[model samples]
Structure formats: C-alpha cells, structure tokens
Target: MPVDAVEVGDLLLVRPGALVPVDAVLVSEHAVLDESSLTGESLPVERVAGERVSSGAVNGASAVTMRAVALASDSEYQQIVRLVEQAAGSKAKVVRLADRYAVPFTVLSLLIAGVAWAVSGDAVRFAEVLVVATPCPLLIAAPVAFLGGMSRAARHGLIVKGGGTLEQLSRVRSAAFDKTGTITTGRPVLDRIVAAPGFDEKSVLQFAASAEVYSSHVLAKSVVAAAKQQGYALLEAREAEEIATNGVAAQFASDATAAVVTVRVGKPSWLREFAPTLAPAPLEPGELAIYVAVDGRFAGAIVMRDQARGEAGQALHDLRLLGIERTLMVTGDVAATAEPIAARLGIDEVHAECRPSDKVRIVSAVQPRPLIMVGDGLNDAPVLAAADIGFAMGARGATAASESADIVNRYDTLASLPLAVRVGKDTVRIALQSIWLGIIISVALMLVAAFGFLPALVGPGSRRSSTSSRSSVLCAPSDRARSGVRIIADRHGRSCGP
Candidate 1:
C-alpha cells in the first residue's frame, strides 16, 4: 500500500533499509531502527513489541510489522518538512551595507549640488559638483570587496552565497551546532572489548568478528573492521545464520581443537536466549555494547561509541577567538549523550533530544543577534534556513541541509568555519574602507570644484582617477586575505584552521 493510504491503526511491514512511512507501534517481537536522520543518534536502536517508532527511521536488518498510529501527512517526517518550509519562508532577508547607505548618500550628494547651484548660480559649478559627488566608489567598492572575500572563502572550501551573507557572517555573535556528524565522527567505532569469565578478549573478539562478518548490520561491520585492525585471523564459518534484529549464529572449526565451535553475536537480550548467565555490560552515556556467546556460554561484550572529531575542540576555540560570543549545541540525542560533548568543546548550552522543530525553536531563541547555525543532517535543514547565517557541513551531509544553508562547507572539517568568519570580517572591513575612501575624496573634490579651485574640465578627470584608486584599494584586500589565510593554515597545521 502507498504511504499516503496508510491510516491510523493500519498494519504495515517495514523492510530493512526502508524508511518507516508513519508514526507506528512495532508489532514484531524485536526490530532495529536507524533513527539518525530524525534523532542524530549515530547507532541504531533496538525496539521491542509495543514500542512506538517515529516516521523516517530506517529499518535495520529486519522486516518488521508495525501498526500506523498517525496519518502520513501528520507523521514526524512530514512535520519536519513543514517546519523547514515555514522557517525558510519566514527567514528575514539580510540588508546589504551598500543598500543601507545608498539613500543617505544620494540625499547628501544632491543637497551639495543644489547648494552649489543656488549660491554660485553657475550651471557649470553645479555640473562639476554633481560629477565629483557621483557615488561610483560607494556603488562598486562593496560588491568588489565581497566578491574578493567570496573568492577567498571558496579557496578555503566555503561556498558563500552573496555579499549580504558575508555581511551577516562578519557580524555573527552566537552560534548553534548539531551534534552527530557536526561535532562527532558520526560513524560508530569499537571502543573496547570486555571478556567474561573463562573467556579472553582476543578469543571473544575473534569469534564475534567471524560470525558478524556475514551480517549486514552497521555494528557488525564495525566489529569486523576492529578485528582486522587488531590483526585477528578470522576463521571461516562452516555454517552461519542471521536472525533479524537479534543475533548471528555460526559454527567455525577450531584450529587447535579440530572441532566445530559455535558462536553467537548480537544484542544482550538476544544473546541471553542462548547464554542465560550473561551479565549486562556497564555502559557510559553514548556507548553501545554488543554481546557475544560461545557454545551456549556467555563470552564477552564489545563496546562502541561515536567518537568526537579530532579537530572539534580546536575549531570551537577558534570560533570563540573569532568573536562568536555564545555557542550552543542542539541535537536529537539525549542529554546524557550531548552534554559531555558540549562541555568538552566549550559550548555554552546544550538542548538535547530535539526534534527538527525543536532545533529551530532553540536556535531561533539564541541571543546576541546575527546567529549562525551549523549542521549536517536532514533534521537540521529547518534550523539552518532559519538562522541569520547557515553553514552546512556539506561534504558528507544531507542534500536538504546543503540546499537550505547560506554557506556550504565543502570540506569534511569544522576548520573552515572560523576561516570563513575571518574572511567575512576582512572582506567587510575592506569594503567599508573603500567606501569611506571614495566618499572623502569625492566630497573634497566636490568642495574644491564648488569653490572654483578646480576647473570643470579637470573635475571629471580627477573623479575618474579617484575611482580608479578606490578600485585598486578594493582589489588589494584579496591578496592580503589569501596570504593571511595561508598563514593561519600553516600555523594551525590545516586541521584546526584553514
């Protein structure tokens, strides 16, 4: 049946890798779900019968039956989409610096021209003042400087949209960040292996990896990779079977004993069916433990976690130095999982277990104006679009988030963010400098012409020369910006800054 046709109380089967179409209650005895898109949890979660699962979570290694509890339009995924549309529609347009000064500059120029004409009664004097007071530098300087800045940002792996975005970026005082894939690596890795009584860690790992190699679960892949990294020689399974959402059971011939050894690897609940004496492994926040059993006896446990990016701490520190006064982390993960990462990275606040709308609300409430939101998931799209400046970690992020962002960081590193800020600040500084230079020179020439010190014949030529000099001043910043970025990159070793 089509997802749109799914009504409340309708029973539906969710196949492995397929998204749940609506909010539903699980009908199967056990199921595994990947809720990363909705919750930012890196690891898949196990759900038993009678548990409710939200829409958009990917079914993992199992075809489970569920009864829909909400209509497709009212589902969690659809609600997030609606929030994104609403947020994007309501986002305020950034006012350009040039535009803000245009009306005032025009009034000032015309006033000076009219005064010259009225006092001197010389049309020639009036023409000369107007010619010198023309806003060429004001008109051209900001765009050129912003283009130069955008070019520099591009070289450093940031794709800034327009001059206004650069202006907003330069003024960013607060920043909100998504947790998984933004601060953390997003991929689960084996943290440690704990062997039960009568079992060695190596033996437990070897047996788990041998059986897990044939399973399609994400955790299984991590276990296999860890075993390979540790130089474990995996024994080929003589017979293997995978029970969806449960565990993998396999038989492997022992090299020394010359007998078939039975092994099982999966959730503690699944392993407990075979090894009734299995003890639960202690876990810290953000950690996941996979249990292993050998020939109906409890063997050991493999602990896994999504590790924080190596450069994340330094990147946050650089942002603080760049004048981002407040930093907050908003994530769909639980507080226990997010607080530690926030504290370690020096983030001032943590909003955990956020839905997409919740993320938008939290980020929208952040103070000190010109807020920037950085994210890399579908759940982050709405909040990204709502922020004053949205930076999408696009290298491996969702397409929706990238599309919604004002600036897309092409590199898979947070180092580009602070570099982008520096570029914006430099670009805006150069633009304002050029504008002021043009205004001062124009006003001086206009006064000189009005007072008969400069001939009308020479006035236009002097204005042209002044405009040329201002253009040169605008272009010089690009070179300086490039050199400055290169210096920062060298000083930080390219991982912490760009």
Candidate 2:
C-alpha cells in the first residue's frame, strides 16, 4: 500500500530485506532491526513483542509482524523529509554585501557623471567618468576575497560550502549543539568493574570481553577495550548469540581450569529476573551496567559512561568571547544524562529528549534571525538543514549530516568552529575593503576624467589600479594560515557584512 494510505493500528507484515514504512510495535516473537539510518546507532537492535520501532529501520534476518503506531506522515523519517522540503521551498532571501552597496554606488556614480556634464559642458566627459565609475571592485573583488576566505578556511580543514555560508557564519548571534557525537566522545568507556561472589573482577571482565568480541554493540566494544587495557587474554568462544537489546550469550571452549560454559551478559532486568541468585549491583548516576551470568547464574556487572570532549570547554569559551549570545545543548538523551554534561561545559541552556522535529522547532524558534547549529549524526540532519547556519563535524566522513550542513568541519575539532567564525568576519572585512578601495580610486579618477585629463574611453589605469588593490586584499596572508590566524579586530565580529 502507498505510505499515505497506511492508517494507524494497521497490522503490517515486514519481511526480511524490507524497509519499515511506518513506526510500529512489533507483534512477532522478535524483530531484528538496523536503526542506523535513523538513529546513527551502528549496531542492529532487536525488538520483541510490544516494543516500538521507528520507521526507516531495515528488518533483519527474519520476517516480523507489527502493528502501526503512527501514520506515514507522522513517522520520523517522513518528518525529516518534510523539514528539508520546507526549508528548501521557503523563499528566504539573503542580501549579499556586494549587492548592498550596488544601489548607492550607482546613484553616486550618476550624480558624479551629471555634475561632470554640467561643469565641463562636454557630453563625452560624462561618458568617460561614468565608464570609470564601474562597480568592478564591488562586483569582482568581493567574491574573490570570499573565495580566498573559503580557500583559507579549506587550508585550515574547514569545508565552507560557499560565500553565503561564510556570510552566515560571520553573523551568527547564537549557537546550538546536539549532544551525542557533538560535545562528547559518543562512545562509552568502561569505568567500573563489579564482580559477583566466587568471581574476581579480572576474570569477569575477561569473560565479558571474550563474549563481546563476537558482538557489535556499542557497549560491547567498551567492554572489550577495557579488557585489552588490563592486558588480559580473552578465552576463545565456540558459539555466540546476541539476545537483542538485552544481552549476549556465548559458549567458551573447554580449558585447563574449567569445562565449556555458557556466559551471558546484558541488562539487569533480563539477567537478574532469570537468575534470582545474581547479585544486584546498585548503579550510580550516569553509569550504565552490563550484567554477566555464567551457566544461567548471575556473575557480575561492567559499569560504563561516555565522557565529554577535552576541547569542548575551550571551544565554548571561545564562542563566548566571539559574542555568541547563547549556547544550548539539544539532545534526545534524557535530562538525567544530559544536564550534568551541560553544567560541566557551562552551556547556558539544555533542551533534552528532543526528537529530530523538536530540534528543528528549537532552531527555528530562536529569536535572532542568524543562528548556528553544530551536529554530527543522522538524527541531526533535519535540524541542520532548517537552521540559519549549519555545521557538520565530518570527522567520521560523509553522512546525512554533511549533506545537510552549510559547513563541514573536516578537521573534526570543535575548536575549529571559532576559527571559522573569525575567518568569515575577516574575509568580509577584506572584501568590503577591496570593494570600497576600488570605488574610492574610481571616484578620484572620475574627477580627473571630468577635467578632460583622461580620454573618452575608459583608461587602462582604471583597470590596473582596481586590479592592484587585490594584492593588498589577498597576498598579505604570507604564511599567516600556517600559524593560527588572529582575529583581525576586536570589534568586527558584529554581523555578516556591511
């Protein structure tokens, strides 16, 4: 059926290799789903009876029966499509700096020509002065300056899309960020190891890591990495099975100290309920635990947490100095997980548990016309396109984020954000300088032309002089980009351009 015709509560049979057309609650025994396309989660998730799954997840190995939770128009994937389309279709206009000066400059040129015609009583003199008054500097030199700025930013590893983006960056009044993969490392690290009775921490960790080697869950990688750090050799496992979102089970090969045993690791709800003897460990705030069981008996738990980036503090501080009025952390993570991180980073506001549509609304609702949003994930794509200016941290390579953003931080550093702003401001300053420089020279030449000192035809001097002004604008950056470029002025960080 067409997506539009699909109604709520409709039971749909999602076969293997099929894309889920709507948000649904799984009705089958189990549903293995690849949600990476919507959530930026790399591992496949398993949804069992009554568990809700979003649209856009690819159904895995087995067929699944699901009851639709929402119509297609209300699904997550379709919502993003709507946001992108609205942003694309909206006829918002951006006035260019060059264009800003065009009208007045033309009026000034006509006034100068009319005055020359009245003074010299020569029709030919009016033509000469008018020809010399061409806005070539505003037209040509400004864009060249912007291109150099783009090239300069590229040399520094920031992929600015166009001069318009640079203009937007220079004028940013506030900034919003997506938490995961934006301000934090986005990967969990093993911070605590809690072992049960009859098991040492190292032993539990080794077993868990050995089992995780056969899994691709984000937490599994953390457990394995922690084991590696401790210099423990993992035992070889014969067969392993992932228990959906709950945990994993693996059978270890018979070794010197023990016979082949089945080891399971996952959530407390799943493990503790099945194994009543399992020791229940109280979880600390911000700490997620992975429970381990041996032969259906409770073993222990591995506690992990994601850490904020070391450079995040400095980056936010720099944005403040650059006059970003507000900084908000917008995330889908719950307040319990998002607030402390925001406080630690000194962010002024926190918008937690935001869906992609929520993020778009947040960005669109900001008071100031020019706001910058920075993010890196599939979930961030819609808001990125909707924001006044969007920057994608393309450290992990091209993604939906990179496609939607106005600028891509190819260098993968938050610190580079302030640098982009600074470069944009300077580029606009130089571009304006170049444009005005040409206009001033031409106005002076017009005076000479009015007195018949120059011919009726436009002189080569007019072109040469305007062309020479370029070197002052472009070539002054002798190795300046190599050493970090300084903010050209303390006051030029006002708006996009004059």
Cα-based lDDT for every prediction: 0.84, 0.77
After superposing candidate 1 on the true structure, give the runs of residues whose Cα lies further than 4 Å from its correct spot. Answer: 1-16, 24-30, 48-52, 62-71, 461-498
Clashes per candidate (backbone, < 3 Å): 0, 0
Worst 10 residues of 2 by lDDT: 489-498
Q: What are the per-model C-alpha RMSD values against the true structure? A: 10.7, 10.4
Candidate 2 stretches greater than 4 Å from native: 1-21, 31-46, 57-74, 155-157, 196-200, 215-218, 238-246, 251-262, 273-277, 284-286, 294-299, 367-369, 394-400, 410-413, 461-498
lDDT for model 1 comes to 0.84
Q: lDDT score of model 2?
A: 0.77
What TM value does model 1 have? Answer: 0.85
Clashes by residue pair, model 2:
none
Q: Supply candidate 2's per-residue lDDT for 90.
A: 56
lDDT of 2 by residue, 183-232 (tens): 87766787788888888898889989999888756467679989999999
